[model samples]
Target: MGKDNVTVLCNCATDEMVKDEALMDIVTTRKVIEFMEELCEREGYPKEVLTDNGAQFKSKEMEKYLSERSIDHKRVLKGKWEEEAWKERKGKCDDEAWKERKGKCEEEAWKERKGNCEEEAWKKRKGKCEEEAWKKRKGKCEEEAWKERKGKCDDEAWKERKGKCEEEAWKERKGNCEEEAWKKRKGKCEEEAWKERKGKCDDEAWKERKGKCDDEALKERKGNCEEEAWKERKGKCDDEAWKERKGKCDEEAWKERKGKCDEEAWKERKGKCK
Candidate 1:
């Protein structure tokens, strides 16, 4: 806070980060942390946070509170932007160097644009005293109490920053929504495929039962049918044999009657002749 003339203020819990100015984005972890801390300390915790990784910065107390609530925290990424590290390092030029370096790694990975004005301004304000740069000027800024007089001109910065901030935030939220939809659709498709496969397998199993079966079952049915046919044939043969036996008895009785009649006739004729 020394050379930075840093101001620490809280944001509203239900505040919408507006983007009316330009494509302004949250460029530092410290900014995000402060924003969240302000909300948490003021109003309440959210059930789900849809933001960039550094957008919802965490402190120990905040983390513990979020953990207790079992709130879902999703990270939304830009092409490569809203980097926190570089801002921390550049934001607080007179702050701790190690933290500044560590924080700038992500920013360095993604820097693509170059502007002469911005580059010169950042380099000039980086590690040098503003007094040194203004040495040639006749009129001077009052250096007596710098802390009490600095906040009067920060609104222009916020205005210029609004649009990009809104743009980055929207991208994050959209990405999260798309990811959820994709996952849900994927799960539903898998479930449908599984059901279709199960139905097909069940149909094939039923067809197999209607076609090929155990030979032993067929053999049992055939044995019962053959046994019944054999009994019917045996009964018919027995009835024909009984009729033939009755006819043979009738023929023998006829022969015996014929022999007895012939003997009586011969005896009568011999008596008449004598």
Candidate 2:
């Protein structure tokens, strides 16, 4: 069983198994390769592996996999190991073979492990030395190369910089324009407000003048009415006086006629009075 609690497959030759660590995650060919790589690094490569003709072990992928690592693959016949004794016999054969090769296998495993370690260390040192050399060369060459590159790209750089400057200048001009436009609009608004205030003042003055004119017209009309009433009363008084004078004259004429021949004097007085 694998750590994931699934059925695991193993090589009976070396008792090496591929395990799955994740739940419901089956072992795949790629995983098998990765497992084998780690196993070979630790235990060295196996000479051969034997398996039944299961799908995992019988595909072209498996063939290519074993071929790449130079591992021999042997497939057992189908239904050959149905008997329990044959299974036991196969296990015994594998154990005996392992015992026979155990000493030689240990020696080869040690040599291979030591050789791989030395090779890895040598490669690491070589890579470090090469990296240092490349860095030195890059530092030395970069100064002159960069200068050349900048020389070649100067026109383009200048154009790019000039474009940026122009854009900034245009933005500044546009900002100034917007600011000036805002100030103008504010000034216009203030002027309109002043005009509105002036209009209100004018309206108030007109109303005041209209009020004064109305007061004057009312006073003049009242004065004209009073004067016309006084004149009418005075004319009535004069008419009454004239009627009284005429009555008196008629009485005097009757007296003169009774007194005999004062008509001429009365006429002369009337003429002089009229």
Candidate 3:
């Protein structure tokens, strides 16, 4: 590395190459010294370093830093070929070359050639413009011719429109027919359903009436049993004994009358002496 601002630094060894590297912006002598100190602190010091006679490397601060760390610094003068080549090629872009090229043609002759070229270009452009105008007029005439032909075909157009209207009307009638059929089918289904429900209601009514008849028959049987028990007591005991056993008979009668007679009627009967 010569006397230049180094952005990147690297180290090459037998075991590792470029493993220990440092990067900096505009590497000055102070920055380079700081990096070296940090590197030595982290990875131990390097034995020797070789560099060119660059300004950053040959500075007094750089020398002091290396000496403090006991690092051997070698300096060599490096020649730059790119700078020399640029200096040699700098003389080729001179004012004399541009002056000779500018003075090659006379002013009057150049203006005459430019005017002739413009006149020829205008003639070609005018011919093309006239041709394009004629083509536009021809297109308009063809469009008018097509309109005249279409006017002669009005009879066929009327027939096509009439056919479409008839087809639409037919489709509407078919839809109405299907709708009527569906409504009739739905009404029949409803009627059958109502008949089934009526049959079930009649059966329920008959069952309810039959249950009431059975209850009446049970009450009649209980009355007959009470009559029979009275007859047996009359045949077995006297009038006084029959009167004494009447209270127990009343209790049995009350049990049989439950759910059969009205509440007020049963209460009145219970309060009677008989």
Candidate 4:
């Protein structure tokens, strides 16, 4: 690399940028640096870097980045292509033939840049003139508007009219919306209340029906239990009477075994008791 050629600082930079609303957008600065590093790895290092006087060029991050990569750069200046190119291209040099071609290229680029600068200046002046004319026309228009507005309404009257108009518009809109919403709500509430009343009546009627059925069932169960208990008691009474009859029969058998038959049998027989 010779110092004759210029390296676009965009080469040394990756595609990162500083995009701010109050300033210009330079969103690809970091990306440009990374691209530069890749160039150093793939191709050779460039001579030097030429950049604009943007804050990003002088930023600490950019400085550190360049310093770490050992890249040199300078701010672009006017009417100093040779010096700028020497500074921009640190040590990048091709063959002598290429150098000659680069000189021709540099000459053409300088002329073109000068032409562009002139054109840009002319355009800026024209734009400024148009802006001034527009500002003057706008000022006149604003003054006329103020005059017309003043003729139409004074401050106090304008305020009162505007407030009343706004109030009436707001009230009309609000009342319409509120009435619609209230009507919907009232209809829904009436429907819900009717449904609730019907549900309550149905629930009460069902409860009464269930209660009557349960009471009848309970009464039947109770009567069955009482009947069963009475049958058990009658069975026990019959068993007691059978027991008494058996005991009396056993006593008569015992008297016969003792040779003391009944009075009728004793009078009719002598040893029939045997």
Q: Per-residue lDDT tens digits of candidate 4, residues 104-151? A: 899899999988998999899989999999999999999999988887
Best by TM-score: 2
Candidate 3 on 1-274: residue-level lDDT in tens? 2222222232221112133323454657877677766655666666676554568878898888778867678654356333433332343344445555555554445767777777777777777777777777777777778777676567568778778878887888887887888788878887788778778877887788788778878877887888889887776776666766786687668766764666667778888846
Residue pairs in collision within model 2: none
Stretches of candidate 3 above 4 Å error?
Answer: 1-122, 134-173, 192-274
lDDT by residue (tens digit), candidate 1, 54-75: 4334455545645776655544
Candidate 4 lDDT at 171 equals 100
Which candidate number has the best lDDT?
A: 2
Q: With candidate 3 superimposed using the best TM-score fit, by how many Å does residue 203's alpha carbon deviate from the native?
A: 6.7
Give the higher-lDDT candidate: 2 or 4.
2
Q: At residue 195, what lDDT does model 4 achieve?
A: 92
- Scored by lDDT, model 3 comes in at 0.64
* Model 3 root mean square deviation, Cα atoms: 33.4
- Writing each residue's lDDT as its tens digit, candidate 2 over 24-92 gives 266566666676666567667676765666676677887898899777877666765344335655776
Report the candidate with higher lDDT, 3 versus 4: 4
Model 2 CA deviation exceeding 4 Å by range: 1-24, 81-274
Pairing residues by index, what is the TM-score of model 2? 0.25
